[model samples]
Target chain A: TLAAPAIAQSAPELKWRLTSSFPKSLDTIFGAAEVFAKNVAEASDGKFQIQVFPAGEIVPGLQAADKVTDGTLEMAHTASYYYWGKDPTFAFATAVPFGLNSRQQNAWMYEGGGIDLMNEFYAAYNIHALPGGNTGAQMGGWFRKEIKTAADLKGVKMRIGGFGGKVIAKLGVVPQQIAGGDIYPALEKGTIDAAEWVGPYDDQKLGFNKVAPYYYYPGWWEGGPMLHFFINKAKWEGLPKNYQAIITGAAALANTDMQARYDHLNPGALKKLVADGAKLRPFSAEILEACFNAAKETYAEMNATNAAFKKVHDAVMAYRADAYLWQQVSEATFDNFMMAQQRKKAL
Target chain B: TLAAPAIAQSAPELKWRLTSSFPKSLDTIFGAAEVFAKNVAEASDGKFQIQVFPAGEIVPGLQAADKVTDGTLEMAHTASYYYWGKDPTFAFATAVPFGLNSRQQNAWMYEGGGIDLMNEFYAAYNIHALPGGNTGAQMGGWFRKEIKTAADLKGVKMRIGGFGGKVIAKLGVVPQQIAGGDIYPALEKGTIDAAEWVGPYDDQKLGFNKVAPYYYYPGWWEGGPMLHFFINKAKWEGLPKNYQAIITGAAALANTDMQARYDHLNPGALKKLVADGAKLRPFSAEILEACFNAAKETYAEMNATNAAFKKVHDAVMAYRADAYLWQQVSEATFDNFMMAQQRKKAL
Candidate 1:
């Protein structure tokens, strides 16, 4: 028989609890938490295990980060923007209106000093954050009526999440914050004129096409929203170095897997939604431009008031400028060409 | 002192070697192999150690896979397309002319049953493969002179890499497979009229711009190329399940890290290249169309002759058609809006 590795002899068993901000029904997002947990357990040979719980099981979805920070839980898998109400700086960890897309978000976090900057802010809350998942660029929303111009947004009550609502409010839109489950009812009963909830995969699950006829492209505010694994600072520091490495690797794996899942599933869900009479419309340039200016103004206000927000925001904006410049030259060009080929049935 | 865990007490010590297809000078690609090894070792508490070697340490760059296949090396890090001569089906594992982009490729691999399909094919070669790294959309090679149309490519000798050469050869261009280190001198002496490498970051390191002033936009042939970690089948099966899981997670981490590094670094390098007199040009639509048609012909021929190639190619093509249709809807629209803002200096 082969001799066992010496380091393995000293490994300690640990069990952790991870609270997810999403329900199990939203598998892509919630599934990432499960994926991370499974990877950690498998890699550790079941010596380290994480038990996951859906939102509201322990605390409300919006309170996940608070639980982690207060040590009520060892960790929480949630979007950082969900805590923007605590401090606007939290929004940068996930996304901001007109911010980086999925690829750019990963680049910024891993290479452009984003994780270090965000962690510096997160440390203040007694938490440490690692990117766990991303939704890629999202759909604008399902709307009962066409929104052709900035003026069309006036007085519209839309169930938009996080910092996006604040930006849109500048255009005279009424922004309502509602839970995912409540969104369909709100739109169906005419309580809300529009609601944005991820992209085709998740949106289709809520049967948004049944409630709203017109669907819009590009959720500009949450272009590439990232979900994070927030660990209690003390708990995170106490981990064995091996466990820390395993968790980090597992988190990164889950992060990539989530986006891949979204990318693969969205195409088919979109085809189904369209087949079910959901009308797809691009957010007109006029509307996008208007929102862009609104987002800029919102950022300016936060930058003046919040030092942490200012520090991270400035770095992201600088990187964003350069990222888009390079992206347009290669990635966008290739994508555009391929898209044209698809449209022409050349593929 | 507390008692050590049962699993740790029984862990076995193991050391392995990884040979990379990349030279150490190209850190981003070669660095991924180092990253994977480091993650694996750290996660295993140093019980499982994998020493890494750049190309030529254990075997030549292109022969890394063969060494693993014959059990001469425990594993190898290489691009699957580099082994296309062994089997055309191998190209689907890395990339093909006018194939999927980075995000799309990840989607196909992780969520679209791509790994299972490729592994089935690799089983014949006595290997088990995992995605290790990706070079997003690559830049079209540096050129001594501009190539405006397909007509300009006639009789041109280009130092193009694997599989892409076969597709472009249909257009009367002679494709030369020169090693990366030799491409510069070959281009300088006019031994090759043009040579394509990776994007701005790697290309800048090689000083391609100094010899070839005309830098091209998209390398349609090698868009979103993936590199693989090829483990000897017998060695992989002999590992404990814990090590297998750890290796899988580490590879995924390195895979995401490589692309993030490229995306973050490319922008600055591109700026430097342009400032240092690299004239950037887009391949003309006429040329792109011609190349796309040629790629289609090449794929079709392979599909008809090779059953393994047909199985994977058909699935990829089916997914590609849908991926683009959905991408154009949300991702492209959002990107176009941002790029336009960047151009107008409104961002």
Candidate 2:
């Protein structure tokens, strides 16, 4: 019989634990972790296995990064922006108000030195990061009333997430930080006037459209929000180079899969919500302009105080300018024409 | 000493050859094949090795798929539409006139039943297809003179690639199938009135701006053209399940990487092309509308004669309508706003 190859003989059996920031109920977001785990195990021939746990099963969702950093967990899948309270720089790894869109975000991360810059900052926390998924541009929120102007936002209580609340608060809106499970009842019972979740597919599951008749779009705060896989640096450095490459490739697959899944599912969900009497609206230009200005102010304040935030912010803004310029010339033009055909039902 | 595991002992030593339809000089397109090969080797710890050869190294560029189908090559990296003359249904795997954009293509392929539909068609040819890369939306082409109206195309000889030639032939334009190496000389000598290769990055390498002053926006025919990894069905099935999973994940990585590279590189390339005296123009609404109508006529003719073509085209069109409707609501709106900011240098 032929001798087994030296490399094959050295293949070791190991198991890892991963904590997810989202519950399994939100399959599109939470499912990315499962996809990553499945690919890892399959590629390793079950020699390496990773067990996934949903939010609160191992640690609370917001504390996931802490668990990974302190070596309590091997990895955690969560949004980087979820940890902004610990350091504002974490926001750039996921998104900031008026940040890059999905394609732009991917381009920046993969080719525009975003990964290097972000990983440099993450190294200080004893962690390494890889982009796990993106939730394309999200809807503004489900609202009980239409917001026709910036003035309409004043004093309205809303359930919002992450750093978005800081910027919106500058506009006189009361931003509530409510958990995903609590958002529905809070809106339905008049505790909050409006609430923002993810896009149509995920939001539809929570039944936000049933109570709030007005559905608004183009969630400026979370435009192309990305989620990340945070790995403990010590654990990562100890892995074989082959396993490292497998993990990197698996993360890339999961990253692309989530956005594709969302794009495929959101269309049907949006149509269903509208058929059930949800009124779709675009935030007026006056309101978007006000929020854009407010977001700038918030960024300026952070930049003045946080050098880490400033470095990433400067790099992102520079890339943003060029990415949009190129996009307008080709992608936007092609898409605009296709959209007109769809409206005429000519397609 | 511990005994070697049964699975590790079973790991086989294998080598496969992959032929690319692109030359090495066009690094972004050809480089995806390299990326795929690198990940496969790294993931399998050099046990499963794939050697990549550029166009003509094994067979001519256009014959890549044929080589894989006949088992002359184990796999190939090529645009599926290159084989449209064999069957118009192959065009759906890559792109079609006025079809889905990059994001929508991935969504359709990964989530909207495109993989199953295309694989079913490919099964007849003894091939399996996986998306390997996308070039995003392409530029219209380089023209010696501006085409201000549909009438300007009359009797104009243009060098265009497969499938698009058939659609554009309806507009009274003469189409020439010129090789990449010969396009510059043809344009410089007025042998061809216009030629298109790809968007800015690849196009810049061809130095088309030196000969043709008029560059145009939006190659409507090749919107989000995807390249595929075509594998021999017998060879694919014989691989261990671990190897199959590794290949699948690698292809997904390559697919996402290509577009990200294009998006990152095109911006600077466009700026360089403009500075070097390339006059940019848009295909007027009148010209685009004429070509759009002509494309519809061509598709109708194909649908009437070809059962496979009709089935795939119908599915794409149905999904396309809803995809654009949702995109216009969020993505287009947000991108339009960012572009306006870019124009004002406000970013």
Candidate 3:
């Protein structure tokens, strides 16, 4: 109780910088970091200020985790999966192929022991992790041509992200790693046949509809790709408990707000995409089944070779299995029935 | 810049109390208020302390909002829909029959204007609202017998909540308003043929499955029932901006954590119930269709007479329509396929 008196004393003003892996141009995704910083400043009465920088300003977007680890920056807002090369376990922090959706991801992280497990792994890298934002289940991609079967994937060069690319590679697709800026030209100029990005909101912004007419649903590879706010372990440890709580609270707000924005904004963008002649398509069951198998094989191979990957992968897989079971009986059934009824009315 | 020096001065200690509609036994639901209080106290270094009281501790559970409005309590952590007797508009701040699920509800409240509209309505009652918790989509209820058709509902006494009861009333069913503690006894004594509390987690704790063997799912009435933190407007306005921020952050954390806990815990709870011979069932298509129509009709009638109800209803309905459209193409399709695949593997 005596601590209350000391705590009421105004805390020291602190300033931090956050570098995001996303470009400022993609506001819905990158804007989440800004929202967190604003919340922190306001919550602390401007005492804890965090200045956010776009991808390349402080460090290259892909190098955000390293810089934070090295304490070059106090924090970084980026997708953990972006650092697949550092350790495959990083993918588990963000999204792996056939990973948890946004709701399920939150459940796994907050309640199903995922945050603790991931944090234990993160401790080795001198980082502390917090869920920052999420792009709800993304779209499959914009494809230059229709993909009807597993055979359709042969020789197709797709600009896909890390773990997902590895999965599809087994289907005879040539997985091409390319930066965001180069994806459109590659798709348009026939250098790549397909490209996967976030969802309707970000994809529409990138003008993917013009370059590729076949818009796909259910980015199965990323059921829900979560972004993280990585704090330098030493810096986080040094903060007063109040400041830590403020940071925790701000990150939680940003996490929920990002998804709300996407859910609200993507509908309008999808409407525009369809109106502009982009054909929306669902990946064939055959193709999806094949990809699922390949994802399993990819995981098995990695589990065999990488101890860290196996640890995180095992935890995520166990949590996801239970989540999927629960969702099937509740969310999945309700949605299926409701959507069917909705389509009937439309017809 | 000069304000920084003044803010550093110690703030006066403040203590508040929150009354919850739930009992302490139901940890996840009632526990959210406790979580919020703990976070606030910790973040404020014990300066701003909130003591949580369970329902009936200070006042009857249903009276939480009125008590907060009159400032008998500083706040109440309860579902806004509990005050449906005050005005049907109250349900929009919570959940309406056949309305948005958890994710969509968050989208509507945070992004599609539900929060602002609901808060405007709440202001008239001298309360300010913040989303505090959620129990994802609930089960329909525990039923002693099969409800295979709309006719099956006739003459059935069901212990249901506010707005949902009104919608289902058209099917010749007798809708009984009973407190959570009394539901099990009523079901056991045959006073009510069916009853709904929350999902598998809470229902199992209440021993509903023992009396009612048929456990129906997808509580259509409460697709995503959200709880609210109702602060006395005057009390809220008197707080420092920093204190308000702490409250906001704490409530957001509780809101997300409540659902995560339910989602994580429910799967295991459900498995245990089924193992104990509780039969899991889905409401039939014909019955669901009839209920949907009844719900729409009920809303229409309310809109015709209730101005406040009309305002919130209009906003929520508009947002939900857009959400449904987007979800069908994305969440619905993906979940349906994924669940089917999951079921196949299980088989």
Candidate 4:
């Protein structure tokens, strides 16, 4: 409240730089970061300007967690989970497989004490995190061959991204970590059998359907994968509180914009994939079951081994159980009958 | 563009009634409608007021279409697809399973001639449709038991709302059409074996998970279910053009608010559901395949039987194809890797 008087004295000018883990071509997610920058400048009456750079312009995409911690860049947008390499506990900042979807993920981060919890982890890294954007639940991977059994996953060379690779590797999968621009070529050259992308729209554009005929459903790994704008802790602390509020508010707007972009574009894209000889496939029960088990084992191991991962994982799993039960009575009944009738000849 | 100057003119005084398809307790969707009403009042210096009533207060939820059509109410917020029962062709006004998601839906409706095309159909019914809100691609419903094969669907009594019921019925589902308030009693009494509803948060509040043990994924029927505010066609036309613009702008604001509410509340609700012993299941391949085939047949039949269905369906389909392809390339690849990484322990 005291700052309000000071703020009224005069709006100050500020300048900053932002780097994104995505290219400008992947407009929705990348565009959120871009828009966040623009909002900063506009909302400040042109007093605040933020210049943005795509991944690799200044650092490797995966290295953003550290670069921001070191203040190499003023800010950056990347998945908090990407920093799992730095600390497994960082996954809490993004999402976990079979975890929360976009709505729940947002709640946890914003209101569910999740922000403070994750901040503890970030404190150690000398970085701060704000939710930049989220993709609602995603689809499984696009594969060259249909997975019929758990055995089918063994020895598979796939461009599986990030942490889910560790779980899948337990089933004998050889996980390949590649950037967005490189995935298609890898699949095309038979270097990888398949890859998982966001959903229909993005996948179709990359022409993954041509290279991988089989498309799967339910992006279990990312029920709601969240992206974050990371700031050096010292840099964040340096800003006038109003400017900080503006930045945080701008990130929320970008979050909304990012999801809006994907939702608007995904439906039509899925249809195109099917039309283009892309065979949509659900992962076989056996394979899914195996993956689920692997994920559980992985979770238990981490909980027992790492205190931070144990703390966050316990918190999230507790949250999920409570949420799932209440939906069965009201929401489920209404939706089931409605969906069941959707395809009917209107009475 | 020529109307830009006119739209900038001051909004005037008005009072109205808005009948909603949702309960007041379901704050998010209902809240959006309320926000629109409130914004109108404030913008017009308290000259405009809108009072919202839950469905069944003045009329049954499904009858909202007819009520607004006949000018029985000033306005109503529901889905155009809900009226597919009156005109099978109305399905195009909403989403079909695996159809356009939110982003594309907004684009088509606002920019791609979709609103014009939809109004052409709505004109016959004497209602003008405005974008009320959208629940970006929703989760599939929850079930009372695990379904491993298509056989489980035989004689399964379920609450499936909207046009989606038409396709699922082919799999031997005994679909029930009921209002939101009535679903719980029916499900609780064992009147239905399964149900589908909007995902997590709302579902949790509804307490569906208490009754249904098996929660399913991929609500194919409603990839991007959009709600519309229906005004009597004559009533709409009678408004000053500026008033009309205000309504549309306000409706857009409401749309965003509803989505934000859902995003914020869903996670903790889902956490609660799982803790209560609810089971999560994926609809078996056979059932999904069956539904897909039936949807195709339904489309074909409608095209052959009705000219309007054929016209709008053809146009939207073509648009969807192009949209899907573009997103697949850009959004999908980045998401896959990011999601997988989110699930891992730090490297």
Q: What is the C-alpha lDDT profile of model 1 across B62-92, one tens digit per residue?
A: 9998899999999999999988998889999
Tens-digit lDDT track of model 2 for B1-347? 25456455435778999999999999999999999999999888888899999999989999998899899999999999999999999999999999999999999999899999999999988899999999999999999999999999999899997888888889988989999999999999999999989999999999999999899878999889999999999999988888888898899989989999999999999999999999989888888889889999999999999999999999999999999989999888888888888898888
How does model 1 score by TM-score?
A: 0.98
**Candidate 1, DockQ score (0 to 1):** 0.83
Write candidate 3's Cα lDDT for B151-171 as tens digits.
999999999879888888999
Instruction: Tell me the TM-score of each prediction against the true structure.
Output: 0.98, 0.98, 0.97, 0.59
lDDT of 4 by residue, B280-329 (tens): 66565566667777787888888899998899988877766655544443
Ranking by DockQ: 1, 2, 3, 4
The residue-level lDDT of candidate 3 at A236 comes to 94
Candidate 4 C-alpha lDDT tens digits along A1-347? 45334433323556777788877777778888986787666544465678888888988778877788888888889988887876788887787766766655765676566778888879988888888777766777788888888898889897776678888899999999887779999999999987987777667778888888888766667777889999889988987654665566567657756776666666666666777998866665467667777888889898888998999998887655533433333333323333343435221
Q: Candidates ranked by lDDT, best first?
A: 1, 2, 3, 4
TM-score of chain A of each: 0.97, 0.97, 0.96, 0.93
Per-model CA lDDT versus the true structure: 0.91, 0.91, 0.85, 0.71
Candidate 1 lDDT at A46 equals: 86
Per-residue error (Å), model 1, residue A173: 0.6
Regarding TM-score, does 3 or 4 come out ahead? Answer: 3
Error of 2 at A20 (Å): 0.9
Candidate 2: where are CA atoms >4 Å away?
A: A1-5, A8-10, B1-5, B8-10
Q: Model 2: what TM-score?
A: 0.98
Q: Which ten residues in a row have the lowest lDDT in candidate 4 chain B?
A: B330-339
